[model samples]
Target chain A: MIVERKSVDLGELQLDSGETIPSATIAYESYGELNEARSNAILIQHAFSGDAHAAGVSKKDGATGWWENMIGPGKAFDTDKYFVFCSNVLGGCSGTTGPGSTNPATGKPYGLGFPFVTVADMIRLQKGLVEHLGIEKLLSVSGGSMGGMQALQWAASYPEMCASVIPIASTHRHSAQQIAFNEVGRQAIMADPDFEDGNYYDGPGPGRGLSVARMIGHITYMSDDSMREKFGRRRRQMSDESSLFEVESYLRHRGGQFVGRFDANSYIAITKAMDTFDLSLGHASLGDVFEPFDGRFLVISFTSDWLYPSYQSQEIVRALRGRVKDVAYVELPSSYGHDAFLVEAGEQTEIVRGFLASTFKKLTPVGAAR
Target chain B: MASAVDTAVRADFVPEVLGRGDYQIIGEIVADGSSVLDLGCGEGELLAWLEAQRNCKARGVEISPTKVQKAVSRGLSVYQSDIDEGLADYPDQTFDYVVLSQTLQETLKPRDVLHEMVRVGKNAIIAFPNFGHWSARFSLLTTGRAPKTKHLPYEWFDTPNVHFVTIPDFEELVRRDGLTVQKSFFLRGDRRITYRPSLLADSAVFLISK
Candidate 1:
């Protein structure tokens, strides 16, 4: 049986420049047994728009998570052997405090009034949760895309805190192409006549705008080849007159489904944070940003993902290689585009399983500790 | 495996460098704690030697599957990749030293390979069989065939050496590219020669920085 628990609180977390934010509620879930050693705990970060329901049946939906394929008994991130922890990001909307959460000070939904949150702020909240759970060190950290960004930040900010880090399909910074896609999505949301300067809470506040934003986002998440293969000029089976183009039907399905769960203001807030994320900022250059990292890293990339191309992952490998030989890289052959990580179960599970075992060995009494 | 006394009948077998050349090439080029990318790293004998002797961490990029498997089996990380395709996959200056040992002559484009090697690595060490050796000259003039000796041992039809180069030829190529030759070594078997060895030497090794 899986033992699950959640801790939601408005804790005080001090920022980097000594600014303290009060009443920060973070929703998280933990599974399995926390051993007496507390060293077998593993931290799994969710990607952009993902919530704390990383594994198992969520109470909200009574359904499994996006990564349901490899997070069960005897699975890659097996709960039988290790305790796993996953939390909603600081700037997320799902069950956690975000733009949709009510502000204690003003007694109104934060909405557009929420202060800007960063990847560093997300890591800080994760640190508090880890500390709250009484875990001294993590066996491994695993994540993909925006989740990978958080994992990399954790490894760099607290190098000695984790035994190993596995970052998948992510770059040190958002590239020009990524920035352009995000900008288009944001524009789609803001251009709607119903947006009304982001005060969309009371009346029918830009549901169409939010759905359009999700449509653009879904398009970017898939590859051109996948789109051509899935929707190549074919019309919808039932609604021929309503949906003439096959691509339009696909986009409408995605956009319609997303409007049911996601909040538009949270979408704007999180994407803006991701756009401004630069792991190499504040440091002299790329080399200097990674100079202080002294840990084992496993960087994985997908071959078909043009959004965050394999070359970007190779840059991370190169930067780590500049300082240490413990870094390893693998670009998996996949045709699922940027979503390959969530779809290519066989290759993704193998790579992650190998990485987990190695990290476990490093922390266990069987081998040399890192 | 041929002993120095017995191998004379066959022409294609070139003896591997059993010991270090006199100048200690790996140590001279590698920094105190550097990562090396050894291209065409045959048998990984030199890389193992460098690691155990000098405490350097070495990874290899070899074309031959047999050599790459051998290197990995020896606990040295090596991958099979073609350098001629460009190092766009590898970020700039990922390695401190990139060594191409006696394999540059066989490449389709030597100068383009050099730029790629330098692009991926901070410094490059290239060693090749000197075509200006007296025996090679004598063989070309007297027998009208490509040279087949201890170092350059291949028939003209089957030789992998597409571009046979001498010390002066390589020097001219380097000078034209605005690259500097940091150090140079001329080898006759296992000893180093200080005198001009363009005519007498059987092979030459060079350390260049771009």
Candidate 2:
């Protein structure tokens, strides 16, 4: 299916940091039809560097969306039965207001002038777009990695608007190690002389810095087993100053490809938001954040994901179970590590499809079998 | 390797429409619209039945990845967890019934699991194959080897059942622990056994409360 990106102009977004943007435009995409009752709508959040074009061939680039395998006519999200929506986050550069967007006051790119955005702010803006689309309640909200964080924030902030949540290969908060990794990515960007303090949009920009950051990111996304199986000790033996080890070359290629598509400023802004996320930051306990939210939870983790380990997902399950809340969890078997949630869509499809169907049945029980 | 032959001979113990007879008994024991938690709920077959027929809100804890997938695919709230590691997090009396059907003997710490079940639910329904049956004892006496019966069909090396208990042994534990036995049902194959249940019955189900 060929899909086009749509935008909604939500004027004036007063952020949680006491900062206000005069005008905010959210770019999004949706599949399937919203029923008369509007209960079949499901909002799928995007991970870091992901855009609103979650599924289908984009009209602009004609490239397939990131999660195209998982959301289609008969796929996991099941567009035939669900009106699935994906929106670019508040601090994203994919047609959403971000650091690359023009500043209304100065008539120039906001760059360093862009207000800090949190994961909370991203979902808060998404809430406005959801309401504008006339969806009173979502059957479920789901995503992987950073996208999972947004789904969790939605359930925490607006439990009344969601029936269930499926947070896949993610954690409720960033550990010290997670924060450390983000710091390395941020430092790489700032160290580049060409960065020019986020004001390099009109110049060559910090392409090398961003590429290094992405190379580090790609390492964390894979497992030791996957690396050995895919690249082994093979050498590319390239003539240029390019990488020699096949794995190194692969990372360089991926990083080089990513530098052209993503903004360095958005990378800094989003990673900081992810590093700062803590569900129990203000609450008395992790259980306290879920005191008012009485929705079912499906928390999934990958067996080899050392970055977001299974133990972290266990903490969320343990907290919910301590409060006697309904929660289900599964540690999927995968050698792909954190990338399993994206590439191993077949394993996730059955559970997500069932979870959504049950959530819908719970909300609208008409004609459902006893 | 010859376990398939044993399984075939014990076809009476095989699953029926609602799964095993123990599941049907569990379905009867569970109250309508009540909450239930099944420990070691393999693919959540019983819980799904309870949800569909009794309108119960059912959840489960299973360790097998494939089984957990099957359960979740059926829209059952089954968490992938080791039972020995779980039940500690669940609040007191959270479920009306905590079912441990046909999985008690396989646990590493059966006694601790039993106590945790009682702690987490108002009632616990336990089902286990009776190792004190006449057929098993006869096999042991005649063959002079590790006895293998239809209900307990495995060689010693491959058997998952670590701690086997009979009806008498279980009742003694319950009595020593000061737990009230609400009900008990003994069975041989698919039929109920009432005469000298410990000696004649191949399996037993007990409902206990503290």
Candidate 3:
């Protein structure tokens, strides 16, 4: 359960937009050991607002990793069998190069000056990290939401690098509805008086705007059923004169906690990247986007996840049908909405465990250790 | 419950280790190393069996989410969807065989689904309970009520087979649709019946192609 945060200097990175970052640093954490063949590596991509801390308890605080339940000695990722790698994304604030990171040229925080990073770019950078670990091929690449997007990009971009992929609660492209949601969040952050056009690194720094944005995001992460079950029309008494609705108080609390851990500039950079994510950007068809993939796939979606509905996952499955010989898809019934991938780990464990085991059996040499 | 007659013809098929069951017959009919798509593949037992025995690339579609979960847990590729709606997402003749086992009688539009199966696959394997069996005829004649037997176990109100078809009715429909029957099998409780199957057999399986 002991976890340590490590940083790697990726040197200068050329952005997809033709912009160049003078220096890039990727913060990552690893669990378990890589096999002699370096084939038992599983890359875990974190979702929007998530960091490198994926499993085990944090050393700084007594807190568990974001995907603590899904990755451990006996968990779905199975640390004992496969080496699990989780890294903070390129356009992330948590210990990675982002808007918060000081620009080498300016000798100050990058703020809005950070180059726009794409989902494909993130995978390219992650490829650097994987190569640094001496792994030529990986067992699987997996994640949910933005993390899932990165996994999809990995499959599309470097098909031979991984043996399998598990993209849960994710889509091949950002739908108009998804783009609109991210746009609203971005607007909320930009409109705040304290935002100061993303140059408030020296000041209090757009706390109210960022909090509002987080509140909007938190609502979309949950379903109507889950929200109703957690907090009905019940109200909380703040004082004898006034009271607040339970749901309102809950959103405010989540927003407050998010502000402390996240930076507003990084939120804009990351959400914008998610909005522009499309696997079929230059391809003729969605199937063409996945035609080069030579690995097994396990695509999962939640029934109540309106933000990224099951149909989106089905679309990916449809595209992959004849193209990939080994692809499995499941739409699990859950009231947890878009956040089900994180909250409903128990329901996902069996499917994930079976998929990894089967894919591993197929990929491993016959005489290799089990 | 396999009879002596069933054991005699079992040698005709390439030997495969399969448990004695109705689906095992369907599994045996499937060609080795051919891709398969099973409609209404409950819990993916047949698909998994095909993968292990025939070494075929198998996929399935089941309407129930619970069954899809079970199928996924067994490492089978299955999508949760209504088969009656058709396999529009799949390209033409993508699979070598499309198997609709036992669940065809419960479909709202069996003929349309069968047509879709033919369109998406080079061949279609269909299985359904024979409503014109002697036991069902005897029950209807004597009791003047809808037959309720081991194959048709549900009560009138709870029966999923809304449009049950007798063996003759299905044969006529197949002929009318211009589909050719490559092979046919009739069973009386796991015992292969070749003589007067419409009247004696309790279940019918057909391998058809357009």
lDDT of each: 0.75, 0.88, 0.87
A9: Cα error in model 2, Å: 1.5
Error of 1 at A188 (Å): 2.2
DockQ values, each candidate: 0.08, 0.67, 0.54
Better of 1 and 2 by lDDT: 2
Q: How good is model 3 by TM-score? A: 0.94
**Candidate 3 or 1, higher lDDT:** 3
Per candidate, the number of residue pairs that clash is: 0, 0, 0
DockQ, candidate 2, vs. native dimer: 0.67
- Cα RMSD over interface residues, candidate 1: 6.6
* Models ranked on lDDT: 2, 3, 1
Tell me, per candidate, how large a share of the native contacts it keeps.
0.00, 0.73, 0.53
In model 2, where do residues sit more than 4 Å from their true spots? A237-243, A367-370, B1-15
Q: Which parts of model 3 have CA positions greater than 4 angstroms off?
A: A239-241, A322-325, B1-20
Using Cα atoms with residue i matched to residue i, what is each candidate's TM-score against the true structure? Answer: 0.71, 0.95, 0.94
Cα lDDT tens digits for candidate 2, A53-166: 999999998999899989999999999998998999988899889999999999999987899988988888899999999988888899999999998899899988888888
Model 1 C-alpha lDDT per residue in residues B44-154, reported as the tens digit of each score? 776765665456767666666456445544545444446565244566787788888888898888998898888888888898878998888888899887678767888
Q: What is the total number of backbone clashes in candidate 2?
A: 0
RMSD of each: 7.7, 4.8, 3.1
Expressed as tens digits, the lDDT of each residue in A173-217 for candidate 3 is 889999988898889989998898889988988888888889999
